[model samples]
Target: MFFLRMTAILVLFAFSCAKKKEIYYCPMHTSYTSDRPGTCPICNMDLVKKEDHSERSKDPSTLLRTEADGKMESKNGMESEIHHASPSNDRSSEFFLSSEKQQSIGIRTELVSRRSLVKKMSLYSSVAYDPELYSALLEYKQAIQSSGLLPESSSSLGIGNLQLRLRQLGLSTEQIRVWSSGQRDPSELIVGGKNGRAHIYSQVYESELSIAKPGLNIQFKTDVYPDKEFGGKIKSIDNIVDKNSRTLRLRSEVSDPGHLLKPQMFGETMIEISLPGLLTIPTSAILDTGVRKIVYVQTNPNSFRAVTVKIGKSVDTWSEVLSGLEEGQSVVSESTFLVDSEAKIRFGNNAHNH
Candidate 1:
């Protein structure tokens, strides 16, 4: 029986060795492999021969895997079931690290808590010149000039059809009167100068429209001058929301101090929305595994457990956590990837060590 068992072990070892296949792969894309040597189709790089580690791969721990986790080999002419991997149904993974290992890995944790999250949204914007408004203003001014003395009020100065057109173009009665009286030049609206101002328009989606208002300040940056930023306050929001884009137009007036900004000049703008008393964590703490978001939470001293979490909006530095954690829980914030890889190796996922 002893000899038979020894023979069975040798046969199994030989079969495992023969199972290894020769593979050639791209160095840049290691996962892209071919049975024979050739250039990688994805990158067109020469495939490098994959080195065989037949001698070094025979680890004693891998021989047993886990007695409880897998079916055992049959004793007499019995077949053994080899489990290629651990069951993936596990939702939580627990592991412990020595203080020395933690220190060497530079592991750091952050306390998850409710805090004010100031999120900034970057959107495409441009220095604007409304053709509709320009046309209406030009015709209104021409009619007033041709009709003799300009009336004191918008109701009288821009009389007839021109007055109705101006009102429908987002120009208030007082603003139209000011423009008619030369308090603000109509020429400055288009041919802007150093002493003039420029109009900036940004599109805000319906989901974020609640945070946008007429008084909120927006910071703009143009490609022409990367270092300089122009600031402006939203002066008006269109009552009409676009059906296809589901966005509304927000218009702001900014002074062209250097007179560099021109009509229809492409630029980007930043709008900040502040949410108070929201549960949040450092953005780096969450490991996105394509299907789920996982965060390593410290359960005890030097002991961490992987917890699946649901996250809301994420900014550059902070991410809002909606579930799967408490306010006082500490999560791995720094060196998360290193810790996660090591934990996988310790918890029977030794393939990750490669």
Candidate 2:
């Protein structure tokens, strides 16, 4: 009988010692933690029990706990904290987090600012070979010669239908006038091999027609001479888009001093467009959810709101923001996926992060 009593006493003592000490703190002044619950000395508000998030977040069915959401006053005039799990019935793009949880997730942010943007386009090009185009140039050359001066100021009566035929062959009116001035020989269209000039044919997709204009400089690289790059300028762009391919044809003139470029040869070309003073952000900051773009803005110390934004051209590390975000706004830049995961857990299928 005495042994049983002694064992029971020992177990009771150990259990008492292992029990976790209760902690309390004023919600308005969280820095003040205490062993006993009462009014806080700093904020003079009633203390509330501190919650352990590890115990709360483990349950997948749990939504979110709104701490200090409201206060209920007692007969003694001391208030108590109310923490409740909210279903978040309405569609809201914002999510809130406590200070400690924010640190654990490694949340980072950057300001949206105006910066100069340079957009680059990469395209596959082929050295051109068109006998039809050569024939048209031959006719244009004869018309110019017959007119003697083929005066730029004169009407097109001397060329007959040759001007229209040249247009159909992709030569702009400006190019026809230049050739008639006797400066650049039109035979270069067909016999450029002797003069060291190569015609290159490349097409741009319909979506990029905004930047497709004549005179834009381009750089070409060919497999024949892997170490060299040739410079060229756009001579003409077709007025019509190819129905089957949805692409606009582009014709360019390249200088081949070493006679290295040959007809029907495969090559690559790059076009660069420089834009100034545009609102931009780090390319990785925008989240592409397969449809719309979303970015998180920190509205408070531990709060963030998801914002849908329209995407624009990207240059280097920065991407242009057409609409949605304003200059000098803070956006989440680092560890965005982790923050998004937490938001998904809180909102379930109703997440509007995109």
Best model per lDDT? 2
Query: Cα deviation of 262 in candidate 1 (Å)?
Result: 4.6
Candidate number with greatest TM-score: 2
Lowest summed lDDT across 10 adjacent residues in model 2 is found at 82-91
Angstrom error of the Cα, residue 297, model 1: value is 0.7
Backbone collisions counted per model: 0, 0
Error of 2 at 162 (Å): 6.7
Query: Listing every candidate in turn, what is its Cα RMSD in Å to the true structure after a full C-alpha superposition?
Result: 11.0, 12.4
After superposing candidate 2, which stretches have Cα over 4 Å from the reference? Answer: 1-93, 137-169, 179-187, 193-196, 243-245, 289-291, 345-350
Model 2, range 1-354, lDDT digits (tens) per residue?
999999999999999999878888655455577998899897586776765555544653443333445333445555543222222432255566666767765778889999877778888898887778777777777777767655654536647678887787677998877766776665555545446678788989988877767899999888888999889898898777889999887888888887777777899888888789989988878888887788877766666777889977777888889999999999989877766655555455556543
CA-RMSD of model 2:
12.4
Predictions in order: lDDT: 0.73, 0.74
Candidate 1 achieves a global lDDT of: 0.73
